[model samples]
Target: MGIFLPNLLVIGGVLILPWVLMLFNYAWWRPKRLERALKKQGIHGPPYKLLSGNIIDEFRALKASHAKPMGLSHHILPRVAPFHLQTVKNYGKTSVTWFGTDPRVNIMDPELIREVLSNKFGHFTKPPPTSLLKQLVTGLVTHEGKKWAKHRRIINPAFHVEKLKRMLPAFSTSCNELVSKWEQWVGSEESRELDVWPDLQALTADVISRAGFGSSYKEGKRIFQLLTEQSELIMQAVQTAFIPGYEFLPTKGNLRRREIVREVKAILKSMIEKREKAMKTGEADNDDLLGLLMESNFKESQEQGNSNSMNIEDVIEECRLFYFAGQETTSSLLTWTMIVLSMHPSWQVQAREEVLQVFGENKPDIDGLSHLKIVTMILYEVLRLYPPAIFLTRCTYKRMQLGGINLPVGVQLALPVLLIHHDPELWGEDADEFKPERFSGGVSKATKNQVSFFPFGWGPRICIGQNFAMIESKLALAMILQRFSFELSPSYVHAPYTVVTLRPEYGAQLILHKL
Candidate 1:
């Protein structure tokens, strides 16, 4: 028994001890060391707490900020991200904070942000995705290095301008359905009050489903519905993620999230299999996103060999991305655009006038959309004010020099896009005000070619589907403006928040006057 006990102790020292030491380093020692290093470099923020660090503080701030809705104002950073606002206010723009044991340094400077995002030597990379986040989507958004480049190359063809031109029919069809429903709701009555948030959500989903899967749109819609539920669960998980293995707990929400992921994958697998078989048989029209992706994948396999081609699992993840990112970005943009236009009726009128002058009663074509100067200006302003994504985060894996700061490995650099977009110094004293004219001279003139305004991100990793999103938004907005003159309904509450993307927390209620 004494010999067995000694052997067990030796085994523990050899195996479990290293893991324990590593955990201690990650959860305690490393953070303290990083904190000291940052402080020495003149970067300071909230003091780090053992294990939980600033996560609990962040949660408290978030809960307090979101307890009630704000007034009708464009200055939404405080409500949308209270903790970040407070940290930046306390420690200057490029300051540090903790997300669990990791140090998060907020970089509100546009030029530094450009360097981080551009990632010239690949020092900064996308932060590893959490398990809950993976439930929402993966593929390109989560991948890095060679995998990201490969996937991006394969997916590029699907979003080319010529390809988007082909998908215009899908965009138009989706908008037509929305117009029809709203028309029916306003039926014979001069005006009707309705909450447009869910309707817009549905519209973007429908467009993605149609454009992504073509004949398998019904299946795609089912997958998106599950994805929506999964996203909600993920947000809930985000609040308590400091608890290790929180996602694996046998809780109702976690179980439901698992179920949702399984269902979505199953549906996507069936749809993909059918599409692949049809394509091989030459019975499929390779026009939609999924078909185009497969065609691209096939060509890539032929050119670069099968090893470089995305496998079935990779294809599935990309499809999930197609639905999640494609729908979330455009829906959030359209919803905010509607709410903003409602707030400023003058701009709405001007946008509608521009739309009318460009297309009259005709459906908006791709060329006409480009000429929508006023409408384009409004969309840009909306994106600046209530960007669908509030911030972008990159982590340093190896020691890197960013600006004047020496960022240590394992430190996260947060580009607070919301703050950058609303900086008075950058956008004048009326930065918070709704003014589309700031964009009238075009984005390059507006920021003098700085990466100050990156709603779709910037550089090599900029969203591939940006053109698709803008085209869809322009088409949807033009159609809505042509069919209806809308204003904020009395029931509308100005509660902007984030759940994967920035959104109107209580839905956008507007009175639609049928024109």
Candidate 2:
């Protein structure tokens, strides 16, 4: 018996040794293999380093470029670290870079991007494992396959034209409050140069709270604050995600992110629970997004004959997503639109004129917003110049052919929307310039018969809230124009950087003048 026991122990040790080595190889050696494969395909960039890869180099470049002031020329692109515009320029349109062990294929071709986003299920899908940040607010944005289809189908009605019309009152109420607040501030003898970014962010948050959640802004404000903090931490994590187990460490940023996530989830849970209780008691009379979602989800549950339809947790995640996705995109749209209008006062005047011509001094209705052609054109132009999401990423789970290249499983692709939007080949030499006239006739005419512009992305998975965002933006812009005229303040800096969305690093400071 003793001899048999010794033999068993020896065999177990031998088996475990290989498994440990294999784990080590997967964590440390696989990335090198990917880098070699990319190199063999004639793809090149900064050479990959151990673990950190090119992350340090990327950050260094971003820091140096950000230190300099932005130039007026459209050619002077925004500064970003680790992955600068220079790298894109140097590597050609379809270059490959190593994000840790993963080989990221950067595709800037508009036609190819259209193919990928359109046929998402066929060629590729959302990354196999979304990061923790994604897990916190996973809904339509992160869902893929059948789940995504179902969610998309169910949520589509919430943003329908009729539903948006219902939500317009909420939008107007929020915008009116913003206008009234600004008017009060402007009435003082001393002129105030305000950072409209934060104000716009707050207004959008309030609007989403009342319109989407049917809740007060007080709770929504807290969620926004948590989301902003989470955004910063997620950016940092993304920069280092290539490193194995980086998120597990108790670093200051990671710890804070975890705490914020907890806080956000807790708050959302309480709100959802309260709303559910109200619904059960037949006291909830709201027709807002929260109410709509609950009603829709209840119907789905009945059809499936499942008691556990969309539970508190599911509602919480969706609500968190509502605030994060809904608020952020509209806020970005408004901020960049304001900046563009400041740059081209003539276009700004044209948009205001169109707004007045259509709606006069009356609050903008759904029909009136739809008819604001000039304002729509200007907004489209701003989106083209500064899209909210600079790039879209996907990972291949099986061997596939893309752009005639044989791609293996685990290869990541980055569809850089910003580069594609500004590509001379697609939009011509004047592509980089802000010309609202391009979109004067609508997106089809604006592209000059090409499918080049994709600010809200392309194909089946285009942003669900595109119409909602456009309506919200048109309403807010119309209200602002009705009440005030503004220009970029001297202290304003043109530093656009990507945290979650491309945003002015300092703030969008504008000198507001009462009309």
Candidate 3:
């Protein structure tokens, strides 16, 4: 018994000692060394606390920001990114904050954001999600390295501009239904007061349903509804993820998120299997996004003889991504466009004139949407002022030099898109104004050669569904302008907050007048 006990003790030390030392290294030594290095380089930020670090502070900041509504102004930096804004304001643009033991540097410089995002050698990649959070999302957005490369290859064809043009009918049909529904609701009143937020959500959801999944909106809307719930739950989990053992607590939010994720996965799997069966029976048109993805995957594998095709789970991940991304980005863009255009009626008038000139009372065609220069400008301006995603983050696994500062491994880079978008230094004197003229020439010309404007994101890893979103937005906006002229309702409260994406905190109620 004594001999066995000694052997057990020896084995325990062999296993536990290295891990304890590694924990000490990770939780103390390395962080301190990195902090001193950063401080020496003049990069300073809020001082960190033990294991909690800045997480509690960050949580408080987010809570305080979202606690009450703000004035309806173009300045959204403070509202959408309270913590980062306060940190930047207090500690300059390039400052550090602790995410647990890891130091996350806030980089407000456009050049630095561009370099990190356009990383060619994979020096920077998105930090892995927490174990619980990973279940909420996956696919290309979460992938890196060669897996990302292959997925991009197989998915590119599905989002090609020409392919998106073919999907215009789906966009128009959903939009037409929304227009008809709104028209019916307005009846004969000079104007109608209605919360268009939910309607817009449904419209975008239906568009994604028909265009993405090759099914009726009624059939696919569950995915949208559940995914929306999932986003909120995901945010809840993100806020509390740093709390060790939080996932095991069986909290209501935790249970709800887990439930929502399961529902989403099951729905996606069933739908994907249905499409796969249809394709095998030669009964599918291969037009919808999912069908096209399958066709593309098959064609690539057959032509190139590559056996490394994405599995069913991988395809489901892509579907989830497409569903969430396709819905969120366009819906946010459209929602903001509606609200902003309502605020500035003159621009709305001009955009309507442009749309009318391009397509009149007819449905907007793919070709004519290209001629919607004014509408395009307005859309770009909204993206600049109220981008759907306010931040982009990248992490390093090796010590490296970036933007004249040396960063150690395990350091995270926080690229605040909204801060850079709203910067006066980069965008000029009227940076806060809602002026579409800045982008009249183009994005490159708008920023005057700075990496300032990337509403859809910048670099090779930029949003692949950008064309689809743009086309969908143009068709919907063209139709909305054709049918109604709207202004902010007296009851409308301008509350824009980020729940995964920038969204109207209060429902967007508008006073709509039939043209």
> For candidate 3, lDDT tens digit of each residue in 1-515?
97999999999999999989987777778888888988999999988776667878987887788777777789877667788889888999999999888888988777787788886437898888667647667888878888889899999999998888778888889999999999989999868999998888888899999999876456579989888888877776776666667887878988888788788888888888888888899988778999999888888778877666788888888998888898999999999999999999999999999988888887788889999999999999999999999878889888889988998788899888888889998988788899999989988899877778887777888999999998989889999999999999989988888888899988899988988
Off by over 4 Å in 1: 1-16
> What tens digits encode model 1's per-residue C-alpha lDDT throughout 190-223?
8999999999999999999998889887887787
Question: What would the TM-score be for candidate 2 when compared with the true structure?
Answer: 0.93
Residue pairs with backbone overlap in model 3 = none
Clash statistics: count for each candidate: 0, 3, 0
- Per-model C-alpha lDDT, please? 0.91, 0.80, 0.86
Candidate 1 residue pairs that clash:
none
Give the CA lDDT, 0 to 100, for residue 437 in model 3.
Answer: 95
Which runs in model 3 stand beyond 4 Å of their true positions? 1-23, 67-69
**What C-alpha lDDT does candidate 2 achieve relative to the native structure?**
0.80
Best by lDDT: 1
